[model samples]
Target: MADNAKWYVIHTYSGYENAVKAAIEKSVVNRNMSDMVLKMEIPMETVTEVTESGVMKEVERKVFPGYVLIKMILTDDTWHLIRNIRGVTGFVGEANKAIPLTEEEVAALGVEKHEIVVLYNVGDTVKITDGPLASFMGTVEEIDADKNKVRVVVSMFGRETPVELELDQVEVVQP
Candidate 1:
């Protein structure tokens, strides 16, 4: 089932990352294995580079060369589908076995992002729910949803101290 899908890393030839990904994708589509093979990705990052002409340009570079990540529900048929793809060396695991990445590993790799809903906004009173400031009540000074950061002004030692915390670290103070 889709709930069983997990991310696994696969190795390919030095320059065959794209080729291997395409082959596996095409095969999945042909076999109607969309439910088995949920998603595939070649992690890439954009970097600003200075060209020979002194012009600045953004270039997309592979985060992990010769590696592709696939989110799939592991099974013999799915394993064989990827194994038979041209240019694929094997899955990154012990004795050619595929191991699904742990939840922590997946989060560290930034392969998936969980959406967060912010209930409190600027000027609202919130209570710190995490970190050293847990149980501390503060007034929201600023909220940056894009960066998942919030600036809260809390009264400490009779003085107002502004602290920055993660968006999820605070909750609206119920009336």
Candidate 2:
């Protein structure tokens, strides 16, 4: 059902991701826009930090702050409803045109789409495919199986550092 809905990014006022998502959900329900409006989400990641008491705490924080992903079939009425929602600024795909996310791009984002592979696991060795650490090899420190993300340590400036990256962005290389 979610895959049938076209994905679009909605820009919201800073610190208003949840509010805009809720407002859109409520509007969709009240106006009976179920056919066009499917699902809404605020992408978040868990982060651990030390508190004043010297205790480590894990909290959920937005991966892309002030942005919410909406899976829906865009129509004039649906667009009107979403645009009029409080805290919503605009959509990200186009200025005047509503460009739907391609299936591959949406799938790569690991939102509302199934992962294409389950090849790598924690302790598996992989080579970075892109980014600054490109071509560097590292062992997977953690695996976000659901989101298809992994934390790997690469030698940067002669120091080993861990960095989070998408699963698809790395290639598993046997040692």
Candidate 3:
């Protein structure tokens, strides 16, 4: 295993996110590939939903269905192990070739970057970069600095719904 590990996307069967993630983790541990396989993640977000009792509940939902992200040092052996994992369809690169993601690309995709930035504070206006609110301008209602997230209000379906957005997915707008 090399010191430089790159991120890559793995396509899995839909609704098998947890299964694939578990399988990858088990494989890494069982095969003693901890150094090569660093992190396995199924990016998810919490959504507030109204229950039948009219109480709002927070539910965690996958941001990208049928997809999992992994950080690993790519090698023939490492690739073989990950590719053979159950529930994984294939890597998201050229056929039979696993292209690891660059640091910049990973950061842009909302994955943790090596270099961290101070997130925008409350009351700051910012432009949404990705997601359904992309290109929409909104003021930060609150900042969860520790989590690198912010609450922004965007008009949806004629109502202002507050959405929690990752810091990297927003660019501060100066008035």
Q: Rate the local accuracy (lDDT) of all candidates.
A: 0.93, 0.85, 0.84
**What ranking of all candidate models by TM-score puts the best one first?**
1, 2, 3
TM-score of each: 0.82, 0.62, 0.62
Per-residue accuracy of model 3 over 68-134 as CA lDDT, tens digit each: 9998988898888878888889999999998888777776667774544845677787889999779
Q: Number of the top candidate by TM-score?
A: 1
Q: How would you encode candidate 1's per-residue C-alpha lDDT over 1-175 as one tens digit per residue?
A: 8999999999998789998988998999999999999999888999999999999999999999999999999999999999999998899999968988999888777888877899988899999999999999999999998777999999999999999999999999988
Q: What are the RMSD figures for all models against the true structure?
A: 2.6, 8.4, 9.8
Local accuracy of candidate 2 as per-residue lDDT tens digits, 20-64: 988998998899888789888788889999999999999999999
Better of 2 and 3 by lDDT: 2
